[model samples]
Target chain A: MTQARLMDGTALARRIVEETAKRAADITERTGTAPCLATVLVGEDPASVTYVRMKRNRCRTAGITSRHVPLPADTTTEQLVGTLRELSADPGVHGILLQHPMGPHIDERAAFEAIAPEKDVDGVTFASFATMSFGLPGFVSCTPGGIMRLLDEYGVDPAGRRAVVVGRSAILGKPAGMLLLARDATVTYCHSRTTDLSAAVREADIVVAAVGRPRLIRGQDVKPGAVVIDAGYSPGNVGDVDFDSAVKRASLITPVPGGVGPMTIATLLEQTVDAAARQLGV
Target chain B: MTQARLMDGTALARRIVEETAKRAADITERTGTAPCLATVLVGEDPASVTYVRMKRNRCRTAGITSRHVPLPADTTTEQLVGTLRELSADPGVHGILLQHPMGPHIDERAAFEAIAPEKDVDGVTFASFATMSFGLPGFVSCTPGGIMRLLDEYGVDPAGRRAVVVGRSAILGKPAGMLLLARDATVTYCHSRTTDLSAAVREADIVVAAVGRPRLIRGQDVKPGAVVIDAGYSPGNVGDVDFDSAVKRASLITPVPGGVGPMTIATLLEQTVDAAARQLGV
Candidate 1:
């Protein structure tokens, strides 16, 4: 059998970022103001700091401004909310990003919601979730939005297909499934509480593994000729899907590091520019 | 074969309305303000008129006030939105129900969005949909909320079950599937674009038929011991499910007319009182 084709999200994300950069440049030149993204990190978690740094670097490269708001680990929920509200009201801020796992003490949803819907470029707020679920015009969660861009680039029409989403995070699996369902796919959502995960996976025409469990979806779980998306990256470069074995069965597959990761920041930058264009009336 | 047990939605709805009436009475006696529901009808379609009248009658019997706003068929979208916004701003209006099929000329979504999230007792706003999708505490679309109540009343836990929701309407099928997913059920959504509806329904442990096609789901489509909810009502009192055959194959099934209909109004009144309590600080 021929080897499965790799859905190169890296290349697609690069193209998207390039387009976004052009648009950002046009807006900056026309309006004399660059689109600004406010990165709000509640604590000094190493991983979150690195992620925020990457996003900021991407924003700079895209001709966008990145404003960092680093708070103490013990920041109260009220303080975080107040800070977010200030960012939301700022005329210069086009998008807002709040790093997650904010020490588990702060009310994350409260803080995320404090960001205005127009500025919810990371798409964590309930307002954004609702719009995404309803297929309305608004920003989507970065990762899931990237996943859709990859699927579209590959000409994967979700309509009438059995697409199983193997996780239900608010921004990732849930929104991905909703986007697929909006396109007329028969969408099923499976998670940790699921009784028979393999049974669900085996029936999918497209499988999106996002449970953050390394190699949880083995080759046997993937249907022959199915498309597999590994959105979860556990430690040691392992993905939610056992890529080596799944690649043998799946007709298309996404590699871990080079796939979903780059698309996220790409989508964030793209949306930030879009938000700025709208806000600037360009 | 042993016949499926009937899920008595009428009895359950009666009990719910009785309790809601008691609460409304309590709120009125203490605050001197009865829970008020504003029913806005655009044009006088016979069926929509009947639905609004039924809801108003139910509200009266439950000791809740019903305020009607009737607009002409040629009413502009802005006019309707202005009316809804006015109702949303009115301190006395605790709940707002905009009857469906408000003529094709009107932008239905814009009209629905005009109702404040607090007064959106009919649960049609994007905010309400977002909250319902996130499993957050908020009002839900009446019919789907009623279906959930019936499921809980029957002690049917959706967790770990295969739930296939047939239909993708804004209020009914979409929210029903989301609610089931929130309870940990592996929820699948099937719509008109589904290639083989029977194949999708056959895998379901819980089947919700809401596509408005009479007798679309037959006995062969139902899995043994499955809980079937027929939320569709076609002409001549027919349901989406072929009740005669499905009753023999399924473990639990709802009957037409008496099953899902009464529960919708009951949930409306219950949520109205709840919304009033929150608004009145009682």
Candidate 2:
């Protein structure tokens, strides 16, 4: 059996970043201001810290400035909201990224709402989700946005396809399914509560595994010649899909480390520039 | 074969309205002010005018006060938005309903957004959509909310069920699917672009027909013993489902005119009172 062709998100994300860099440069030269992304991190969660650092590095590489706001672990929700409001009012900041899972004490939704819609580049706000759901012009959640780009790059049209999304998290699976639905795909959302996961997977022409369970989707469950996208990244560099087995059955597949991971930050950078351009009226 | 049982949305809606009326009376007695719903109608479209009148009549029946703000057909987006904002800010107004299909030139979204989230009882704003999608504490689109209540009334547990929603409209199809997904049902959204609509419908344990097409879903398309909620209304009182055929196949089915229509207004009145109670601190 022919092995499934790899959907190289690394290569695609690189091209996207390069294009975004050029736009960032053009905006900077024209408006005398480089695009800026404000990264707000509350508390010292190791995973979140690493994610923020990586994003800041990407911003630097893409000719965008990064402003890091490191809040104390015991910072109150009101204080955090106040800080976000300041950044929202700051004309210098084109985009705002709030590193989440903020110690479980903070009102995450309230914090997200504090960011202005125009600068909500991370797309965590309610406004962004609504726009994504309605297929209107607005920023998108990064991981889902990247997934769409990957599909576009691979010439996989979602129109009229039966796309099964095996997750329903706000920022990831939910938005991903909505984006697919917007593209005219018949989209099904299945999560942990789903009674028959395998039955749903078998019917999918496109399967997006995002439930964060390593190897939850196996080769036998995958329909022949299906397009498989594994957006879930567990510890130890494993994805939600049983990649080794799935690749044999899938027509196209995204690998764990190099697939969705790279596209996320790439999308963040691209949206930052897009926000900056719009903000600067360039 | 035994015929399908009627969902009886009209009876349910009457009960709901009675309960809402009691709440409205209590709030009015305690606060010395009835719950006020401000109905903003843009343009003189005959259909829109009729809808606004129906809503106002429902408000009166539920002991809620209705304030109608009629705008001329040539009203600009700015003027309409300003009127909505004023109503949103008014302490006397507990809910705002902006009757839509406001001319081709009007920015409908902007108008909807003008109503503050607290007063968005119609659930037309982006904030309400996000909350509904995320299963958070917020008002839902009236039609979708009524559909959910119908399911609950009939003891149809959505959890572990397969729900297929045949529409993608912002207020109806999209929110209905999201609501079902939030309830832990594996939800599929099938629209006009769906290649095999019947196939998708056949797999559904609960089907929501909201595409506003006449008899689009035939009896054969519905799975035997499925719970079918026909939320669509076309010309001549026809629905998206062929009532005669679907009633034979469905285990429980809602009829045209008597089903979702009355429930929509019932939900509106309920949410209006809820909003009023919250704002009045009752």
Give me the candidate number with maximum TM-score: 2
RMSD of each: 1.3, 0.8
Instruction: Kindly report which residue stretches of model 2 are placed more than 4 angstroms away from their true locations once superposed.
Output: none
lDDT of 1 by residue, B64-152 (tens): 99999999999999999999999999999999999997788999989998999998888998879878888988999999999999899
Candidate 2, B29-69: lDDT as tens digits: 99999999999988788999999999999899999999999
Cα lDDT tens digits for candidate 1, A7-41: 99889988998999999999999999999999999
**TM per prediction:** 0.98, 0.99
Chain B TM-score for the candidates in order = 0.99, 0.99
Looking at model 2, residue B47 earns an lDDT score of: 95
**Regions of candidate 1 where Cα sits further than 4 Å from its true position:** none
Q: Which candidate number would show the highest lDDT if scored against the true structure?
A: 2
Residue pairs clashing, model 1: none
Candidate 2, residue A23: lDDT: 97
Q: Write the per-residue lDDT of candidate 2 for residues A95-213, one digit (tens) a residue.
A: 99999888778999999999999999988999999999989999999999999999999999999999999999999999999999999999999999999999999999999999899
Error of 1 at B89 (Å): 2.3
